[model samples]
Target chain A: MTPVARLSPDEERDLVVAAELGDHEARRRLVEACLPAIVALAGTFRRTSRIERRELVQEGIAGLLLATRRFDPSLGTPFWAYASYWVRKAMQELVADLARPVALSDRAVRVLATVRAARADHLRQHGAEPTTEELSRSTGLPQAQIERLQAAERTPHSLEERVDQDGVAVATVGERIADPQAEWAFDDVLDDIEVGEVRALTDLLDDRERLVIRQHFGLDEPAQTLRGIATGLGVTAERVRQIEAGALAKLRASLARPAVAVPNET
Target chain B: MEPQGTALRHDALVYDSGDEWVELGAAFLRRGLEAGEGGVVAHTRQGLSLMREALGADASEVRFVDVSAAYTRPVRTLASYHAVYAEQLRRTPSLRAVADVQFGPDPGEWDLWTGYEAAFNRSFSHLPAWVLCTYATGSLPEAVREGVWRTHPGVVSGGTWTRSALFEEPERLLRGSSAARRPMQVLRPLPVVDGVEQFRELLARELVAERMPSARVLDMLLATSEVFVNAEQHGGGVVSIRVGRADGRFACEIVDRGAGFDDPLAGYLAPRPGVGAGLWVARQLTWCIDFFTSADGFTARIVM
Candidate 1:
């Protein structure tokens, strides 16, 4: 937070020379002169909290001091421009360090980075985007990892975000997510049928016959096509369809017999 | 910048991981120390922490600076290094420094930084310093890594340093990128508001009305949403988005009015601890991801 002195070019050069010679006070003042750039550089890295921002600023100060010590006025570059790189470097390094532990190898991170750059370059260079094959060739990373890395890098969207301004939802991506058991149970179309009718079928048909009719028609499932029922029962799908038709016919005849038949049917 | 009468030695080393980098750093430091030359390592926390652990007692002797300092801009980085070497050489005629920008292949960022690496050749054409620009190949794109060879006159890999036959001076290589590129066939581009919901609705309607493949629609949805978030987060104002079929594939372009990304991987790199994958997922689902930034702002073209 120290104020940097506004020195003339010659005087600043002198201060820079002194600072480079291990002169602590001169170095401190030189660092002060670069603080504005340091603070600005610190702002570039995104921080989650006040503490982390402060930490990044502290790191920038470290860079400022290094730049002061390393600054060679003989090179004719102004102090701040020379110092900003170190400032940015320090802050970015901190951000990189504070990075979450990645499940990927450092190399994979590098390769992913490479693939991204190549694609961008290809995009910019050519108005057209590059295919994975082009990226694989350009980036020299394997296509498989390249594909995976690209997939992993996109920002996730809340399926909830897909609605229109008027709240019309074309569809949702996350609706696919739900409790399996609840999904399975709530998915049961059989629940729509009366238990009495279910029981009537239970008594009217043999076990396999009732099971095939329900399963084929998707009474128990959200909707298992007849083909799925046949596969599950290890029968031809056509045969399952025939059984389903026969079962429905029998049920119709049984129901037609009226209320007096219910007790006797069981 | 003051002119250096002496020709500078610019070299690049490519490595895959922290361990390889540490080995290179250790040797770089040893050579400088043994030869009685000033030694400095511009370390980012990524490798510095590991290098610190690896060097044990030896970590203290080297003059360490942050790699970020030189990275805010390419020219600034070179100027900083110029100062660093110029200062180091005040004690002695020759010095050796190891610095890593740790530039992973970034989309917009790499294109910007390549010029920086290219500039190094001329920036230090005079100082009698061995500037080892370290690149972690583990993270770089092949083209960007290939760029390292073009920038540096020398290349070191697998324990041997050799003159790079691939080296091309910046003048020859740093030309207009668009010259070689063929423009894509774009349909009637649609004006889009910055709002995500509107963007989604427009995109969905277009895809569905076109009877775009369901899988393609999903990819387009994710890509558009991802790019929309990027434009909102990084760019501002009215954004432009459009969807069309090109080369028998569904394609989209999302353009924003910001200066664009400083790092090409800006959208992909998880800045916060718990942030979700951003553009990376968008790129993954799509057949292609491309980006460009200029005075107009940033634009992304994606196809699937």
Candidate 2:
């Protein structure tokens, strides 16, 4: 590892002045000194996309050079703070050029991180997964938004993608054991909860909802199409789809609860 | 191909029963197919199967597209359908379609789908096509049901086709429907600036402070800059700019001194190279760009 050059406040000011005054050696030294910090800054801006760390660092360096020409020490804004703005802007523009299909906003990423933290805390305290409502209340995100965020977090993984456990590769994602009971996995909303808890959640739903949820996900029964479910329930397929959506929402709301108060049967 | 004398007949068929929809849809397509008009059907799997059963021997005449797969993006879908319509019109003077769009589940997605429906009226107006958009009111949300009435100029129901009494003009309906949505929560007023660069910096500070990703912030900045330039060039210059947060989405409202353009479909069509490219870019970058007029002035509110 290369030792990063650290300059004190006055020294940094002198270096900036020297670099700005056509001192090639001083500019080279300044670039070398800021290299480590630039790399670290690039790390935070890293995305899951194909844009590389090296490319981002190059963009940051371009910004640093621009800052060297533009910065006025008399402005009283610290060199690091002023440079950081230019650095971020350059990298941001590069990413935006490549980000035609915009990734989730930083707020969404932070919210998801907060939800994970809250979920961990809930599991630590309660010894079970938290319901969407509990997570929403704890994180201050709306439940609907929480559900949507969770869905968005799922980037489609290749079947060959490795599943890791505590930094160790365990198995491929496709190699995971499937529950024999569910022909069509009830994997969208209530996948995190255990089967027993799922049953408890479903118990809180009315007869129609229970039927819809069961038939839609093929819980213990053969997976039936929405059209088939609609015929069996004596309703339109669209109505069946709506009932299934409502039932899943109900299940998501009631998940991990000790005892859910069932709604009055319609 | 020569331009068809008649405009596209866009109608909504709001039905509760599956069997009835299949019957009406089959009849609509069969008549066209038998008359040597081109036929296309894009619908949910269930709708397709039911329609196929109803059409029986005649089902082979029409092209089938899976609605779930095809209707993923509004802009792309419009482009694809435009191509299909252009190709069909070379051989047949008229085309008929059963377009039972599978609307997305969330509000943002719903906006895209509804916007596509409204934009379709203008995009396909010159094509000799009859599109029947089916809405299963049995399970559809009230907002979507209302969107159906607003977007479609006519309705076909109970074996009768009639002009919808509730049908507002497409541009009016799109603008009104968007304006009718819950007002964004304006947390604070952002400074109105003269040049695009200053406005960009100001908006960037607000969005970055809200922790939006930089790329997204850039897209918003570029888009807002486009609108800012448009304001200067046409809308008598921007008067005020306000930033707001609503349902975890960021909204920037730019109020201008000029009356907003009357064309509702103005930034909607995928712009022809030299045409209104700025607003088109703005519309592409943001979730939506809703234009409104008030006693104060005309406002273009962008949500991302």
Candidate 3:
């Protein structure tokens, strides 16, 4: 492996200045020069998993790129000094992501769902939502332990559970009655049981639609221009507009439902 | 003795005042350099422009020492800068005494200044003498007064008023001051699932309102949303959000109710394949990002 060469402070500053001024070559040079420092910093986390090292380095590189573009030479400091914070922060985030589980086991996910249902049922049976303390008392678990367990489950409880409302049902909680806009947004992505609304929104669209939506909404890529998306999609710019409108309409229709029926009516 | 000798020879001693003093100190340092005698000055890019005009054509080599102040104590920044400067001085036999200037006039300000002074004084006591100057002029002291007033504006108006106004005009001190703004907006507790969307919307609105470029704001919103979503999916949807401005920067925080990982630093050090992009997206989006997760919860903050 070739050893990474460290740029002198002035060279680094020059690269940063040029990069900030939209000089592509200088931006590339800045990334190349800082790559070694980033790698060495990544090395310090040797105890981390191999996955973490790769992620941290990549994150560090991204940070270095951003630092280059945003770095103002007028600030009177070397680019490296300003870049260090972003680099380390990127590295730390990589470590944190690794430590966090990306995909829960199917069984664990099911268990969480069941636990949430059971908790809600227990609250309904008792005529009041069980407090963490009460749940701990009834379940014979430490409060902290219960809290931890609950977090792992990620079950969202409704506001009604906390109040003394007996007539409200779980299905009613999911009803499309109260706020039409929220309900429409919620319904548009509710079809896929496995994924939540946001993820479902992604799944609902075709690749072109998804990319356009993501770019236009600034979801995935940096902001996109209408012309850019239109060119990418091989459609007229007006067609791009039609596509967006069509997608939003479909989403709204899929997610929207008639207002809830009044109780005991039909 | 060798370490002491090295400390004495350095042209200047640099200290990290954390984010707290970087701006004020940089301003002071720029002024000092502008009154130049070919003195070498080093700081972050944010502080560099002010000193550029002061850099003489025949100025001695000016080296910038890059250091992290996030999650570091003010004393730590000072200590690390001192170490770097001392080492450099040791290498240069020709350089004479180091000039150290203390800035700002906050109450605890003395603690950091005095500590640095004591360390340098003790370390370089045996060497040839150098001047240690302190500046609390204009906005430097104004920042300190603002900090005090935010907490105790009444007391400041009473006895401390006269002392605070001496450094700068009272109206200039108070006008367009960050102290007038609320310190932090305490958001209602949000579930990790729904809260992430709400937080993203709020961040988007703020970014648009502030006229931050669309690309930058979008990047931050996406990265933050991902973190919050992960908190809900893995940590049990326990999360909180807070936003505020401090020290001339905008900050947003996303806290999750989850025991921090067994090795908090390990995740960033070694991430699972293909998942590294989320963090990369985050880093690309913000000027500074900090993460703190413990047995109880995780807090990720972004500064722009």
Candidate 4:
């Protein structure tokens, strides 16, 4: 058996810092150290489904990564205490997903909608609250049925589409987008773009035009208006507008013309 | 606590013939005397004699009334006599009929006692009020008993044992209390399988669909497959499996048509145990396990 050496407090902190800075080995070590805790939290929801265990573990790992990124050493609380809330919330989401189907029957949804509508109407007209019995009688449904519907109204189902083929249910989005094959196909399409066509477009734009366009649209938040773009570029709104218009015209004209076929493909 | 009434020294006894009409009448009198209140007893001469033998000297105080003579009297005269006797008894207000055999007690008292007795017997026996009433009225002939037993096998077999009777009321019995009975749901038998893999897969699918807990569902599947495997390897090739849920628990039973084992657990747990690992695993997984084996075959139940 390999004797495991325990890390000192300073060493642990350094490892966490290194992992957050994108050190693969440090990240792997951190995950190994935290796997048991994550698995235990996931096991709390074992009464739900086994598939939920793997999913919750993955979710916990994601939360752990996020916590590492956002961790503040100045905060008095330990890292585990800070990450506990995220881990619990992930597990709760898994349990909620498991309980969704039985808790949200169709009849219940309709009954709830009807009751909400009736309550709104009653508040508008009578200005007095209606009793549960009165509501049940008014709805022409039994009190028991109404109570079941009320309980069902509280739980919600996940919105992801699932396809069941040959008795195996799988998520369509996960299968399509998360697979390596799909990533390869996407890369292939990007690769097929003509390099000369791209160079011609780059040549058509000056440095200022390229920077404005890239900062405005290619980054997370697009520039809201011409003025915002000009402010970022340290230029006049008119100059920013001229650059944007010229960049757009060049791209449009290039797209309108035929693509230069790569000889290697033939 | 009310003040204690004086204890009356009295004894009334009853006997049964094939008819046993007179013994029932005497028994009614005994109950009344024991209660420190008097009541009538209507009986034939032969029944009265049997009661006399049973009670000995205590029988001496009993005022015997011949129902045969009452029947022979003119209807109008008898009716008038009955009314007068009833009124006279009310006025006297003693333990009036304790050691006596008479046609009936005072009309109001008769109605009250019979109704009270009906409620008492129903609660005591956990049988229906109608059955108690029929017994009290001496109307439960063999034919009536057979009919009732046939119609309601559960009642006949005494499944509804009344653990408490203090809270029972005549009104509740008359209203037909449904709470006294447990609700049972029946399900069709599932096809028997040779291995646990298929059963586990089915259970896993059901669990993922939120039909049941994965552990309990897996436990039931494993337990059921264990029983089936027992039947296949030892008893025969395969048997039948039936599954259902009751009282928030799942249950499955496997039944087979083959020679039974001497001791079910012993055979399963003995040396060179064949397919016993399955049974052991099932036991660990399930909450309760039971087996019934006879010369005919075996039936095992696993509750989870």
Best by DockQ: 1
TM-score of 2: 0.44
User: What are the per-residue Cα lDDT tens digits for candidate 3 across A1-266?
Assistant: 21222665555555565454334455556666666676677767644222434445656765665455445444455567667767776676555534444355575466446556657878789877778877765655455445544644454444223322576444433232233222222222222311221124346667777676566655534546668888887888788767865664454333221112223656
Docking class of 3: incorrect
lDDT, candidate 2, B1-304, per-residue tens: 3333355889989887887788888888988887778788887444665575467546656776754334534654665576566556656778898888766434444655777788888766755689999888887888888778777888876768878777766676666545343334464577778787567657766766665543355457667877888888888998888887753357888878887776667666643323454665566556567777765578788876
Put down candidate 1 lDDT per residue, A176-264, tens digits, no spaces: 43422233232122223112111323467788786774443333333356678789889998887778657645643332221111223
lDDT of 4 by residue, A1-266 (tens): 11112565556665565554444566667666666676667667644322334456665665565455444333334556655555555565445534545534464467678887876777778898776677776776555445545544544323344657798876643343343222223223222322211232345567877666545432223324567878877889788767865764554343222112223555
Model 1 per-residue lDDT at A200? 28
Q: What tens digits encode model 4's per-residue C-alpha lDDT throughout B1-304?
A: 2111221222222222323434444555465455444344334433344454444334534444433222211221223223333433343333333222222221222222223322322221211011111122242344333322222212211223222323334444323321222122463466665464444444334333434432244335445555666767777654666666543345666667766553323212211112234554454445446666533247666655
Give DockQ per model, in order: 0.04, 0.01, 0.01, 0.01
Location of the lowest summed lDDT over 10 successive residues in candidate 3 chain A: A189-198
DockQ-wise, the better of 1 and 3 is 1
Off by over 4 Å in 2: A1-266, B1-6, B14-16, B30-37, B52-63, B69-94, B101-123, B137-153, B163-166, B171-222, B240-246, B261-281, B293-297
Listed per model, the TM-scores of chain A against the true chain A are 0.35, 0.36, 0.37, 0.37
- RMSD, candidate 2, Å: 28.3
TM-score, candidate number 3: 0.26
Task: Provide the lDDT at A260 for model 1.
Answer: 14
TM-score against native, each model: 0.34, 0.44, 0.26, 0.21
lDDT at A143, model 2: 66
Give residue A219's lDDT in candidate 4 (0 to 100).
25
Q: Worst ten-residue run, lDDT, model 4 chain A? A: A189-198
Candidate 3 residue runs with Cα over 4 Å from true position: A1-266, B1-198, B262-277, B293-297
